[model samples]
Target: MQESISVCHNQYILKPQSIESEELENATFHAKQRAIEARQTISPWKKSHSLYETGGWKSLFENINQPLNLSTQSKEFQTRYNESANSLEQVVESAKLPLCPSGQPEIGNTVVFGVVGGTVEAPSIAYLTESQPVTEEILALSDSVKPTEIFRIASSCQADACRHFDGANCRLAVRIVQQLPTVVETLPACQIRSSCRWWQQEGKAACYRCPQMVTDNGYSSKILQEVGDPYSK
Candidate 1:
């Protein structure tokens, strides 16, 4: 009798590593500080999904006007209002891109890792080359594993369902930067870099540590626990 065995081609195992408890504590503290700083910079409208979608510029205008009474006949006021309106319009237009989560299966991208071996102590990973397709067989295999163990990346519109979203920015990106060590000085060659939310929000710093990220279904890192996983309640 012959037996069937699954072969994962173009796959590389990501060995697990340990971090000192003190190091984890520091990362967690820093991640909270980063989130606080980030919240301060975020526009009020950007933090609310309803406002962001309804029209961030419109909301800004309403807020600005709520505090004062303006007359159209006043030339100086009209001029200042027009300038502010133009600036607000520019901001609202630029915020149209949808959010994309790291784990979402976007078409064409490869399954970067499988969750076959991972634990709370050290999350294991299995990487697939860019050329490899995430076949139905692969996805089926993924279903049998812990949801967090299977890591995949693909292009897709960002939506409200993502945990990292604060209705404004991807907090996960910020936490990842605060927690992980930069494995590379330069941005790793990534197909999704252009549209990546992390790159868009945090820039080069996010890219520096991106290679070390794994979307664990369980709370795998201290920083994640501190920040509160969006996927969790």
Candidate 2:
């Protein structure tokens, strides 16, 4: 004779079993019906009462039907997240933009802060009492060399538009703080200190280290190469 629930009429027979969850019972019964209609049903070959009769199966399904506390927790988490986001948005919106000028004069909106005796090892940037606009005559001075090799230029910091800007912050400024050694104890006077991107991001640490950074390093210093490299891990 066949075990308790065997096929009687070219169908996968499932002997009825009591299910505690009404929703789960309806869903499973519908799924069984669909399987039979599809003509691709499998036999309950594990055992006759393997589907739901065992205490393990009953307990598992009963546990699944228990009400979840996740919704309340999720709501609380979202409220905190919203508050933090609003606070950051307020800060970003009100803050004045700082300078992040590159080496080129054609980039526009730049000021020259005359850098003297710029050697491969390191360069000291001498600030003018006030910034001088980068003009064609000044650019002509560097016929054989890069303009930045002779001059330290400062310009308005481009936030998201620049590659160095990682969304909310400038990675270049962060690198300047982390990789470069502080050269000055007191904050060095610069034309752009109040509006310098590095100053805004890293405070006096960046200013202290500012004396060593060259706009166009030409991979001259190992530390400069590492600090200026945008792709470093």
Candidate 3:
């Protein structure tokens, strides 16, 4: 008599290395501080979703009178501002991408709505500081595992002038993904920052906050959250 064996499929494991050493911890702290400063320089009205919801042809004419408190003298004013900020926060959260707690850029550099692996498990800022393993393991794994097709949402970036924008779609998922280095530099900068509706509405920098912004080249043991495969020996 012949016996049969059963196979079970599980989610792919992401073996990320730790940068918990003292020196790296200090570097991570400093890098985060600089990023925060850069964030402060930009205006808050730059999110595209806000502009789209508020106007169409006259969006440029509408007033983004949302004032921030550089100084807090009045309790009433503070309460109102806090309420408004919380409301906007909900809206922004809906549009923001989920990132790993360690600050690693999403693998494949894109996310598809129903896809499982697009999300990393860390808080947004901390994830940015975490280092990832190099991509050679994935390449080897790809020899047996077929590359999966992933999807990205195409919004108002059809202006033809955008680099990642192809006619009305993104070509980065095709072109960039193929050339994606084992260690990616900072997340890809918002190629569409200048005219991105989000930037116009929020008065803030374009997707500089995206986990995938191209901030630096490749991951380092001292810098980014590393990537690895647990199955490998």
Best by TM-score: 2
RMSD of each: 17.5, 33.2, 19.8
Tell me the tens digit of each residue's lDDT in model 2 across 23-114: 33233333233323322322223222211111122322233332223344235433443454546664354334666734334333567763
lDDT of 1 at 144: 33
**Over 4 Å off in model 2, which ranges?**
1-96, 101-103, 116-118
Q: What is the C-alpha lDDT of each candidate?
A: 0.40, 0.48, 0.26
Candidate 1 residue runs with Cα over 4 Å from true position: 1-101, 106-134, 155-157, 228-233
TM-score of each: 0.44, 0.55, 0.21
Comparing 1 with 2 on lDDT, the higher-scoring candidate is 2
Predicted candidate 3, C-alpha RMSD: 19.8
Q: For model 2, what is the alpha-carbon lDDT of residue 6?
A: 29
Worst 10 residues of 2 by lDDT: 48-57
Q: What ordering of candidates by TM-score runs from best to worst? A: 2, 1, 3
